[model samples]
Target chain A: MATLEDLSKAVINGNVAKAKKLTQELVDAGVAPLDIINQGLIAGMNVVGVRFKNGEMFVPEVMVAAKAMSQGIEMVKPLIAETDMPSEGKVLLGTVKGDLHDIGKNLVGIMLESRGFTVIDIGIDKSPEDFVNAIKEHQPDIMGMSALLTTTMLHMKDTIELMKEEGLGHVKAIVGGAPISQDFADEVGADGYAPDAASAVDLCKSLLSK
Target chain B: METFNTTRSNFTRASFEVNQTIFWQMLSDDQCEEIFMTVQELLERTGVEILNEEAREIFEKAGCWVDGTRVRIPSPLTEWAARTAPSRVTLCDRNGKRALRVETTYSYFGPGQGNSFVLDPHTGERRKPVKDDVAATAVVCDALKNIDFVLSNGYPTDVKEAAADLHVFEALVANTTKPIIQYIPSVKHAQAILDMAVAVAGSLRELQKNPFFVYLIDADGTLVHSDETLAKVIFAAKNGIPFIYHTKLVLGETAPVTPAGTLVVALADVLVGVLLSQLVRQGTPVIAGGIFTVRDEENNMLPWGAPEVSLVGTGMSNLLRYLRIPSFGFAGASDSKISDAQMGLEEAFSMLHMGLSGTNLIQGCGLLESGLTGSLVMLVIGDEIIGMIRKIIKGIEVNEERLARGVIDAVQPGGTYLGEEHTLKYFRKEFWWPTLMNRNRIKDWTEAGSKSLGQRATEKTQSILQTHQPEKLSDDVLAKLREIIEKAEAAL
Candidate 1:
């Protein structure tokens, strides 16, 4: 039997071809899909994340390894969906209005999704009303706001104020973006401020738990 | 003659003490002079336009020979510099003095939370400055180098107090060197700081002798041929103060989403600043700076290594070099938190690109949270990174002397060359020994406390603060500075 360790090594090696083929082969060999995912794919990715978080690995390495894991997941996703599996959480992410940048937000979404959180990436330049509507409809556990420019990061506060005005205070607001600091996040009345995508994911996880 | 020598020795009891380093060891005083001369020749040979006629006259008077676009300062200028350049400045109060020894190649203070794009400490806000904020900003400038010749940051809330606030702030920070970057918000403050600078310098002639100050202000954000910012730039340049043309290109709003378009906008803004600098004071330096930003798909303004950012930076650097203007560029900037993976990646790439492109000074260091926060911890990390980048830029020098002693041939009979004088002399010069990086075995590392880079950096900061007692300035100079500050403050 092909062990999870074998699949984990494949992912670490950035062998997308091998990881995908092994995932399918293991599933075909009557391996449980959750075990294949949790014990194999996620287990493999966790190492990558930890290594990346520790500076043991660099961006290009992590990026390629992430790409490999995603490729493996593509093969197993539908099969896993057919089974009764619980999700980590749902996160609705967007950049506030007047700010069109989103690389940081995208990284956050990828990391969250990798952690099994279903993320609704609403895209950038979204108004506060758009966020409220998304929260109303999706009822996501967390709404992440991102802004790059110092001037535009101010719009995150406006969005939060608008959210408060609209009586949507129950929804948790997580804020990020370049130029957005813990101090600014505090002033803006955000539930959390994350410096980068890795921390953002960690913050979201902790917030969801709370 | 013997009596005269003794008195001269007494007079020169304490000229100055500088931060000694490998860079200092590499160049003798004569070599430093030669390099400066070479730089001047390079500046003149490059076709950077000299726009100001008055500056041209000054350069001519100073024996600065100009051939087409080339400019060269006569040896007399260097001699004059040795005499007039004060070693230290004393910024002070009635109680005492705060003297700061000047450095030839080190960062002075840069205004704004440019060190880190963070919220203002006083108001807990992330926008423009008010009066008190401007006054208190002197603390930031004071914490920097001692010879603050200009009022750097926190422009006043109202135009009425602008000049006065700037003067007070400049006085508080200005110890010995005249403040170069003083933006008198009003005609009164402008006149005041200028007057104070001239007084401190001893005369208008002295003030004009070396215009090594900067003044920060803004221009109208229009693409038109004429603008107030340009006018301010012109005025400062004409007066011998270099202007920093600072602009931020916010992707998706102020600039197009594409990095190219964003870079173009940044380049255009800088060109205007440079043009204004040249037109106002030919041959005076102008920092054509651009802080470019981008928003990703989810609206997160990520610290991206957009090739366009580097491309434009390199292009601008080349252009400025062609123009023979000293260029200051951005490097070692990271949106990541301290000592993390993101920090490693962000800092490494940013430093490499900026250094490779030949930026004269990389301003945003020791900042975190997207340049909104400052951490002493991060600042030390930045220093290390700067050292690393310097090594990368100082490409290996291969020569017959360096190859040395015919060592390989000598060692053909199984003799070791390790005991040779050549190896002893050259080895130390050829290698950079780091202060904090650990290369010990695991056992030794554990035995030696297993301290991380952060811990080591913290220890170093504490050591510098505790042990490095910078030389103090005279009480008279300190009193003069305080009096000027008080007058400026009362005026405000």
Candidate 2:
């Protein structure tokens, strides 16, 4: 079986091929896919993410590690799917109506998913009804909205009001975008505010625990 | 109706009769007190300018340095220093309105985003800005009151029609009660705009009255010589408009590694522009311009902000202020962070120091993500911050009236000041209520659906666009502007 150091280096160095090969070797050697995934790929990615947070690694390094993690995910997605893989929580996410910009929302989704949240992304320009429908259908623990344009971020308030009027206010709401703030979230009756993608994940996790 | 001149207006268009003393000035009572306090605090506590040996020496000799962060200069010398600084400038466009009393100490400029240039849904490739774009851009310039002047977004594309573009910008800008820094490129184009400005002002006296303007160096902060500089100098001298020398310094991939070396190189380029400006327009204001950005290890321009940039920005601002020349620097900007955190932190920190250091033009208002993009929401946020800083600059009033002597007398018995006539008279004037910043209770906020600042600003922007239609032009003026644009486009 490949040592943790080998797997660690492969992930940190962003060597997707090496990581895949190492995973196969571990699997062939009778090591469980769970161990390889949990202690190897995920653990390695955790390290990469930490490094990125501390500024020890920049965007390119983080990107490379993300690539390696994705390759490993591709190998294990079916296996994990078959076994009802553990997740942090369920989140319903979408950009508010009239707002098409998605970079901020996409970042939040990726970061949440990376943290093991089963994210049901409702896509951009989703109206309040769309969010309510998704929440009812999915029964998500939390609903998140994103908007980038000042013009469209207004829709977040409308969505929140609509959600309340339509009996969906019981679902915890989180809002983020270029212009959204703690004050704005509070103003819109959102349960919490996440300033960035990383913060959103942490906030989601905290909300779940509560 | 009250006479226009009697009104307490921010729009003050006045000039000095050479050698006439306006002794009501010096540092102005408020400026002197603040500077003295700042200097004393800086000198007593921190030994100001210890890093720069030359500045340190100067400080030690002229200031009573108590510490690195504080220094005290005598009031008379402080007044002399303040008097040497350039105060008001005017930014004029073609259609009769020119933003006057525009503080040239600091200003900002940047373009809108790439994909969102055209508002029309059906436009193919962001149709090259026609007359409508010019008119819209002019309104935008007016709305962006923090921007001291105008910069060319796409090249104006016409040497002869430069006058008309200037007219559109000036007409729209007439709404703003601030100065206009005319951004010109080629010499011929510069001449065209200047001629138009002169024609619009109606006389040399009107131009002289608001003579504080800029024939800005359009060399892209590089050393490349261009004919625009020559035209600018000639027009500035002939019409008495000031000149702002600009140089942009990009570090990491563009320049040296060390921040100091980058600053020196940038300063040298600025000095070249300054000298050229002075050579062309004697006694005109020559300002230091350009932004310092960097490329990180990934070569992605690394979020566009560096601490070194701020430090250098402050240092250069102080340097120019001391040298008796006006300067400009990036004030309200951020790297890649797009949220309120980015806006709050970047806008306050960047502009605060520049304003404190007394840089003449601190641009970068309403800009975000390292000046790569802009948001109307961000601009409103910056404006609120500017209001706060203006309060800071105004400082506290410790006079008897402010001390509430009469109110104390009347309320000697247990009573409230809130119900007093004095309170009623002054409360509104004293408070700076932000348009979008909600300070209401959570219940009230939620009842209103807790709209974000962006949401509120969007509504405000729409309302302004819809209701506050600016003063319109006559058919004759419209036809003239169109003819000018048509000829220019045809040639292009």
Candidate 3:
């Protein structure tokens, strides 16, 4: 009999085909859907999260593991309702105008996504209007802007102002850049600033709690 | 062929050759003499311009022909100067206690000087460092046990233009008791700085007898000496003050493209320098070094982190050892913009070479972007890296006590040693401990903050700045130094 532990080991190994097959096999063997996701996929992800946090597992490994979990979720979601699939929160991320630097921004996006947030990425060199439009469309819990240039970081403030003007100011604004500081974030009306990608995940968790 | 010898001492480890733990050599006696003779040939054939007229007159008095400002010395004069120079120098703390005794193959490190931008540890921004940054740098240097001495750690741009050098030195004196390597711009400024040192030492001749500071001068590549630089060199030599004279040779630009060719030019530059210092005042303490750089068409950057540069630096250090003189070289620096893998690898390899090659007075710690940027976090990492190298250089002990023959006998086959007395006695001393590198398990690391090495370095810098107060100078001495600076300010 296939067990949820087998499904978890498959997911931990980042074997997407094996994970989906084992998860289906567990379901056919009369295991509950919640047992497969909560005990198998989520349990595997929890270990990966701890390892990533500890610097034991790098981004590529966790990313592959996350892919397996997502595929397993695709098989398990139809059988469950919205109440079982727990979404942590939503995050909107973009690199502001005149800055083509997006490697760090994309790392933050992956960090947020892997932590259970539904991240909406607006891509690089995005203007204030692009962020404002994405915010209106996604209505995300947190809006994060990244800039590598000192000149391009001003667009973060402009986007915050547009959010205020549109009466969507309840969304928390977080800023990050190579040149960004917490004092600069406060001066520009951002609620948080993270110096690196991993801290961006902590910033999201802490901000969402408030 | 390679040879290995093992010896034992019961109480302490066996002393290696010359009673040192490790030894590494590059240049031999024949090569040393060849380089010295080459320098003599270069000076006589292709002369250096003794830019100052007084220096030119001194060279002429010593039987050197002068064509305008350029002067050439004879092989006999070069041999005399090299022979007459003192082989050792001892530097002292501000309180007049001997702190550093410098001679062959003894390496120490401190921060380099003259950076326009300092990375704010708190905000990670690049800004012009002020007098307060100098204070912070000195206090941190005081707390770092690995850094043997201090320097005018950065260029403070916010002070009065004429008094900036003194202001930086004052901050250094106030915050740390470590001997300083200072830069005095002119003879007038050197006089003021000398007066300040006299006040600290309580007399001029006493300060000369046990100098608390060493001044430095710059040379423009090979055989290009500026007048002010030469003047400072002469002043130091005359007053029996320790002086470091160095030149930056950018390969393919200021020097030959190949490492060997660049080394030839560098030897010509530094040997000529040492020869001149000895001529000014025999038995004067002079430290010679070359900050060698490499530039190819594919990689035209100032390759401070390149293997080619390290090769030349190691060769120069070996040559200095053969000459029985203290040497200056570089380690623990990088051209990367952050404290990333590139910075770590470059610093680790360069530090290994600097250790094995026996380069005394290693500088360029905490420097980034090839000396254009400074970071205190990098300094913290440098302190750790040097500690590791020093541990490696301590080598292994093979004595019967260290071998633990009795303990091994007591523990039977397939038995454990974790519960034995031998483990408890030697584990801490045998292990190489790290302060910043993380060694935590995954869960524990996640529970704590998941911090990077840069973040850890920044936190360490902040705590040291806030809590570490160095030994201070008396109020009267501070006031006297200020008065001397005021006098120099008037002159300027």
RMSD of each: 24.5, 26.6, 17.7
lDDT for each residue of candidate 2 in B1-492, tens digit (9 for 90 to 100): 011012233564576233211111213445434444444333244322223233333435654342552333343433333343354445444333554333534333322221122322122123333434434444554565444454322223233454544544444334333345556555554554554445445555676665424566544443333444544544565566666666667665555666555554555445434443333334455556566766656755645345656666765665454445566766666664454665677777766665665666666555555655544445556666776665565545543456666667665654444334455445656767565577865655888988886566556555554555555545654455445445444543
| CAPRI category for model 3 | incorrect
Interface quality of candidate 3 as DockQ: 0.01
The alpha-carbon deviation from the true structure for residue B224 of candidate 2, after best TM-score superposition, in angstroms, is 5.3
The lowest-lDDT stretch of 10 consecutive residues in candidate 3 chain B is: B1-10
The weakest ten consecutive residues by lDDT in model 1 chain B span B1-10
Model 2, chain B only, scores a TM-score of: 0.66
Q: Between the candidate structures 1 and 3, which one is better when assessed by TM-score? A: 3
Residue-level lDDT tens digits of model 2 in A1-210: 587568767877767668888877776777666666667777787777677666575444554565566677677666665546657889999998887777567666756665567889999889888988888899988999998888888888888898889887778899988778788899888999986677788899898888
Predicted complexes: DockQ each = 0.01, 0.01, 0.01
The prediction achieving the highest TM-score against the true structure is 3
User: Residue B166 in model 3: shift from native, Å?
Assistant: 1.2
True contacts kept of 3: 0.00
